[model samples]
Target: MKPASKSLWKKSVSGRVMVSILVSATLLGTTAACATKSGTDDAAVGVTDDVIRLGLLSDLTGPFKAPAEQQNLGIQLYWDQKNADGGACGRQVELVTRDHGYDPQRAIALAGELNDSVLAYQISVGSPTSMAIRAELEENEIMAIAMSWSPDLGESPSLVVPGTYFGAEMVDALDYLIEEGRVAAGDKVGHIYFQGDFGEPALEGLTYAGEQNDIAVEAVQIDPSITDLTAQVAELRKKGVSAIFLNAAPPQLASVAGLSEAQGLDVPIVASMGGYAPQLLDTNIAATLEERVLVVGSVTAYGADEPAAVAVRDLYAKSGSKVPPSQMVVLGYAISAVMDAAMEKACADSELSRDSLWKVFHGDFQIDTQGATVPLDYSTPGVSPSSQVIVLRPDKSVPGGLEVVEKDYAGPTVAKFLDR
Candidate 1:
């Protein structure tokens, strides 16, 4: 794996570079004098002489349970590997996890319970859950790595999103379709999405892309609780949409593909990161997905021949996990890697507090996932690390049932949408 370039800490943001340098120099000078420091223990929320506690709030028994479980496993593997390497700095990292079940109220309670116990939250699973706890986290100066990529959360002080927002992903997908001749200007493009925050950003992106490209976009909203999408597919077919963008969960994507095929609507289908789950390949609609579905995301595919992907696979194997790796697993590993990088920086500065973490996070430091994820630059608030995306098609031959069709595919629509 490639080490994070030292130049990043000195190049991206001048203010941050100075801060980190000054802090590191000052801390190093005081290390011997404060070696036996004890009264200041209360100043560091989750830091001890030999441990640094982190929190993970995830959904373990809710709609997103499958991905949540995989994410948790990936995070565990990352920390395990870190601890095996003598941990970050001299402290052994500990992750305290809680199951919020995708409920905002439950997340609020959990945050209250963990507010003073962790240095930061390594992962917050849902958009709503993160929103519910945003105030408390900010008040307590806790930095949380949000799992949701909602654009609104992009600018939040207490939360950091490791990937591109759903809106940008949609824009990139549409741009790809238009560029590849899958769809054209003035054609009717249908967007089938869940009705809430989870799907709204995608619809915004599709609409924005449509306006820019002169493509007619139509939205078909689906209730999150509903599974069958035969009627929705039939409606889009009746509209004569030449291409469809689905912003729903994995099972929903499977249903749309299956029902669309059943209805003889064989138009090209593009989906957000949430749309392609590996388990869908084991379902009756696997063939349909393999034929029609294309997924877009900010991370590299699980089977990519990158050092990070190789490391993730080896870690899973070492843990004796019988289940195959998937996008969710890769996501988990990537998030952990990013957070661990920041944590390491904080430790090196001997400032493992929330403020120090935020400083390191927004510094010139760019997370080098070694090709596991889109390289992230948190220096700019509300801007994504990389607008470029990896486009993948469902293929049964791959371990994750998806293969890269294009790596870091950039198109006209991304700049246009982000600029807006």
Candidate 2:
């Protein structure tokens, strides 16, 4: 296929077949009719007579390499099962993958390289990378499902993110702590965040939560290279914070968890989704995480009691892959399900072009992952599909190394923050 161009989209849509959403039985009936009507394989970039291709911009060898691999496995697993079931629109789905090593420039270069070869990007791994490529994606009319939860993602109509942003996640986490009697309105809360996209947005949410509840929030911003949390933890300890919120990676999480225990800063350590890694259970800080840490996010926890979560676990187990349980896998599968639905919608609409797929993303459609995540609605631009989040705690026994503490949680402050 040629690179995406205005002429290509124009030609592809020249012969179109309009249709509404249909059930499985009716959908099968209409699939052939639409193809027959269109009468040409020039339907869109990244699609051919017998195959549909989607791009995966992943991080295979970077700071997030472990989770990235697990996520890649989930993506492959979903497509493998999908192909076995006869694929979308009677065409096999293929992933055109590129690893950016979690670097923004590399991500941009890869996206430019794959622009015309895939219908859409099924995965864009990092917040900075997603933001860096946002303008190019809009110009090219390509849709992408960015895995990062940076609040800035909502500004782009072409990008589809799975759950609430980092800001809202922190807000909900605060609410969970307050409800659990770990924190109260009169107390001070400390937040240690990276100074960039990931941590800054979370600090916004924490600040908003504190303001709404009349609580004081102590902000401690750290650079990514700073691994030790001794000074930050000591500062918060002096402030006598009721609880601490973290928006850093696993190594930082370890420092905070371990140092807090040693220093006797007894408080619930709430974290954003990026904070905890499943491998932490094998570390010396495992008991500390289990006792005080609470990880919050919009995605469902691995080994969650939900049927969809259980089904994914079973699927992975049946695949016989040696990779241990990780929430990243569940996330990968869930996002793929979202993209798969959009592709089918575009195909059913009888115009499987980049333009049509872009429309499907911004159109009025609700995606149900059957419980793997909150049902998603991307109809409204600049808004998250759902505000609901799940609170999790470290548990070695669980397949994902974390168990759901609150399955469906949307705190009082979330709606206000999102609106603002």
Candidate 3:
């Protein structure tokens, strides 16, 4: 195997050199490999010459607080590590964070605030929040990386960026179940969701995939205001569902899993990209939730068995935040990894402006390049609608970690079955 070159990148102020000779599409590319240990800064904006100003929006004080706070720990840790390393392209990257409380209006305000303060944005929670701030984000031309799995998120803006999204992820989960023979093509798959746009897309994807692959689909919807899903479970069981798909958060997911287990339903229960986590596992409904729940992910969980994941472990240890890493935390690291790559590429060329970073994001990314994880394939146009995903199963042996049972699986990703 070819060893990576020294980290001491050469710096210059001359015209940009197209470092194409060392390029490898499957590798980090010339940007990360040949980037000079140097960068530009808008001192007026408080951006230090050796610092890349970055921002993060999360639900630290809101309903999504548990997941978003976990992401904050990871994001802060990422910047800490980057600053320690002299940051991407020879400069340090400073990360700024905010709490949106899962409200779109507040998210818009937060986006504007970050726009005035930094170069880029990273999000850790909420569709409503994203929907609120998207316009302002585009107006500022800031590069955004997020953990939202919404399909519409893939739609690119002059400034907005879509992170890992949902529909395609469901395809990954469904495909895994199929390939593993956990369910057959002719079986009836159950869908249980709270009525909302967030849950609607998965249903759309499930129905679409079923039509293409030949499977039966059944759906059940429960009121989000309700405390339990015993009625929903009974309805699904009456339909004789051979497999189950969920598009709810932890509390709801736990409730459904508990009810299913209580009713002695043996069908495989799969969750959308952000369903089950350590929190959901140990809830009042923990017993049943631990038995048969799988979560599909648009990004790797923090406990990933990958190179970047190792970096995250180091961050987690240093932060002293005891919460187990979830899609939110892991995506925090992953987005940082992408930003590092983009900043390295842009700063090497002495173009560290928000617009410049946007260009780099469009050019330098290689998420799951070799299919190691879910590849963020920007080569295709829309992001959210096309993002791939992986399957995560709870594992007792990994202490505060999840075991990914499948990789780049596309069967569960389909949404047609849910539509039926």
**Per-model TM against the reference:** 0.90, 0.91, 0.83
- Deviating ranges (above 4 Å) for candidate 1: 1-41
What is the per-residue lDDT of model 1 for residues 81-175, given as tens digits with 9 covering 90 to 100?
A: 77776666556789999999989999999999998789999899999999999888766668899998777676666788878888888888899
Candidate closest to the true structure, highest lDDT: 2
lDDT of each: 0.78, 0.79, 0.61
Q: Write the per-residue lDDT of candidate 3 for residues 65-124, one digit (tens) a residue.
A: 777777677666766765665556556667777887777788788777777878777553
For candidate 2, the C-alpha RMSD (Å) to the true structure equals 5.3
Ranking by lDDT: 2, 1, 3
Better of 1 and 2 by lDDT: 2
Report the lDDT tens digits of candidate 2 across residue range 1-420. 012344423433343333233222211112222331234456388887778899999888889888888888878777787777777667888998899998989988998999878888989888888888988888788889988887677667667778887888888888877877788979999999998878988898889989998889999988878999899999899989999999999899999999999999989998888888989999998999999999988777888877657766877888999876688888887887777777777766656788777766656667667667765666555666778788889998788899988777998888988887
Whole-model lDDT, candidate 3? 0.61
lDDT of 3 at 78: 67
Q: What's the distance in Å from true for residue 244, model 1?
A: 0.8
Error of 2 at 82 (Å): 0.5
